[model samples]
Target: MTFDRPHDLLKRSPANPLIVPEQVRPSRPDWRVDCAFNAGVVQVGDETIMLVRVAESVAASAPGELRVPLLAEDGAGWRCTVESLRRDDPAYDFADPRMVVLRADPAQVYLTSMSHLRLARSTNGTDFTIDDAPFLFPSTRYERFGCEDARITAIEGRFYINYTAVSDLGIATGLAVTDDFRRVERLGLIFSPDNRDVCLFPRRIGGEYWCLHRPAPRHLGTPEIWIARSPDLLHWGRHERLAGAVPGGWEASKIGGGAPMLETDRGWLQIYHGVDAQQRYSLGALLLDLDDPRIVRARLGRPLARPAEPYEVTGFFDNVLFTCGATIRDDALYVYYGAADRVMALGTVALPELWAAMGV
Candidate 1:
C-alpha cells in the first residue's frame, strides 16, 4: 500500500508499511508470519538496525479449531510445540486477540501467536533487508511464551536492550546487552510481573541509569507510566509514579513509554503511545527535566499522529499506532511504528515542527 501523509504533523513515508509479514521468513516451515511490527531501532555505524517483533502462528489449523505454538522446556534449551483447541468448547474463551484463557482455570493460558525478535538492516533508514534466521528466540523460562517489543539504547559503546518477556508467571520487562547484534547476553527479568513497555535513557543521570516503564494494574490503579533508577543497570530501585492515563482524553485508557528519550537543551524528549476507551491508539510527546527525568515539563495536548489511513484502521488488531523505537538524524525525527499490528511503517517529523507543536 502507498504511504501517504494522512496527518500533517508527522509525514508518513511513501514507503510506509515498509516491512510486512510477507517479507519476513518464518523460523519454521510450518509456522506463518501473522504480523511484523513494534520494532526497536538503533544506529550502528552507517546502518540503521531494527529488532523487529515478529509474531507467528501455525500455517494451518482444522476448521472450528485454533492452533497455537508452544515452546516446551527441553534439556537442550527449548523445543517448539503446538496445541490445538476446539473453538466451540465452552471451557475456553478467546475474547482477546493476543491470548486464549481457560474459563475454569484462568491461570492456564496460551498465546495466540508466539513472538520473537528479528533483525532488519537499512543503510538509508527507508529500505530494509530482513535477516534470514531468528535474531533472538524463546529459550529460557521467562521467554517460554516469547520475547516481544524490544527497546534498544546504546550506552558506553554497548547496546542495552529492554523488552517484554511473557510466560505463565506474568508479563515483565527483560534486559539484555550486546556489543554486536550477532550475540546477546541475557540479563533475565529486571521489572516484576504485571509490567512492561520499558524504555531506558541513553546515558547515566546523576550516577544512576534511569528508565520509564508501565506496570499493569490488577484491581486498583489503571495502567500508567512509571520511572526508576539503577546504580549498575542491573538492580533497579527508587521507583516513582511518572504519569497515568488522562481521563476523558485521547489517552484515557492507558499510556506507556515509546521510543528512547533524546536529551536536548530544553529537556529529555520522549515519545509515548496512548489508548482511549474505544481502543484507538495515538502517539504523543512528554518533555522531562534534563537532570530530573521524573519531572514532566511539557506535554503535547494533541496527538502527534494517530490511525487515519486504512492500513492503520484495520488489520490483525485495528486502530493501533504503537512505536517501539525512533531516531533523530540532522534534526529530523524518524519514527518506526506498527500499523494495526500487521506491518512496520515509518513517520518523519522535523524537530522544529515538533517543538512548535509541543510549545517547548
Candidate 2:
C-alpha cells in the first residue's frame, strides 16, 4: 500500500479534540478544568472508552496568591498550599508556567494545577461523551501530586492500568486492575521513583510478563525507553535499554512507549513518542521479537505522526503529540492521542499499510 505522504500514515479525525476541558466538569465546585489530554483508550462491547487526564486549577480570587494541591502528610488526600508572591520577591522564581520555583532553593517547586483521570466514551470513535465525575484521582500519598498518563492493557479477561504517579518525591509508576471499569484494585507503586511511562504487554511472553518503561534521571542521563520482565506484575526486573533518542531528529530529546503493543504476523508492533531539541513530540514505531520482546526486530526511521495541524501545534503545551492508547478494529488502527497537552484527538491508519510501512 502506497501513501501520498510517507509521514502522513495516520489520518486525523475531522472532529478533533473529541473531548475538551469544558466538556468535563471539575471534580470540585471550587476547581476549574484547565485541560484534558493523554488518555488511555480501550474497546469495550460496542464503545471506545478513554481514561483522560484532566488538569484542574483552583479558582482563586486573591490577586497574588497561588494555591497548589499537594499530597498531605497522611498520604490519603490532597491539601491546598497557598503561596503569596510579589513580582519583586527575591526568593520567588516564575520561569516555567507549569511550576513555581524558589530562587534561593531550587529544590522547592510547586505545580500550577492538579491532574486526574476522567472517563469518556464514543460509539463511532470520533464523537465522545465525557463523564462529569473523575474516574481516577489522587487518592494516595504517592499520587498526592496527581495521576498523569494512563496505559490500559487487557490480559486474562482483566484490564491492567499503569499510570504516572507524581508527588514531592518525584514521579513513579502505579498499577491498578479492573474486571469492569466500575471498580479498580490499586496495586500501589510498582516502579520506583524517577520512573514512568510503564506499558505492559497484553500477555505473558517466554513464561513471564513484559513491560516497557522510561527511567528518567534527575540531572545526569537522558530519558530513554527500557524493557523489563517479571513473574508477577508487581515486581519487575532484568531491565534493558529498548530505544533512545537519535540526535538531529524530532525525537532527539527523549522517547517513551505510546500505545500497548499490537500482535501482528510480523511481530509485536509498538508505537512510541519522541521529543526533539525544540520540544516537539512525534509518534514512531518499533517491532520486537515475539519470543523475546527485548530484542528489537526493526524501527521506523521516521515518525508516523508529527505536530502539524492547527490543534496539534498550539494549546496548553504546544507542538506535542502524545498517546497512551490505540485500538484495532476492522483492519484499521484507531489512535487516541493528546494534542498539545490540552485536548484529546483521534487518528486512523490501515493496519496492513502500517505493517507494510514498518518494513518488517
Top of the candidates by lDDT: 1
lDDT of 1: 0.90
Whole-model alpha-carbon lDDT for candidate 2: 0.85
Residue pairs in steric clash, candidate 1? none
Each candidate's number of clashing pairs is: 0, 0
Error of 2 at 276 (Å): 0.6
Cα displacement (angstroms), candidate 2, residue 170, comes to: 0.2
Please report, in order, the local distance difference test score of every candidate based on alpha carbons: 0.90, 0.85
Tens digit of per-residue lDDT, candidate 1, span 175-198: 999988989998888998998998
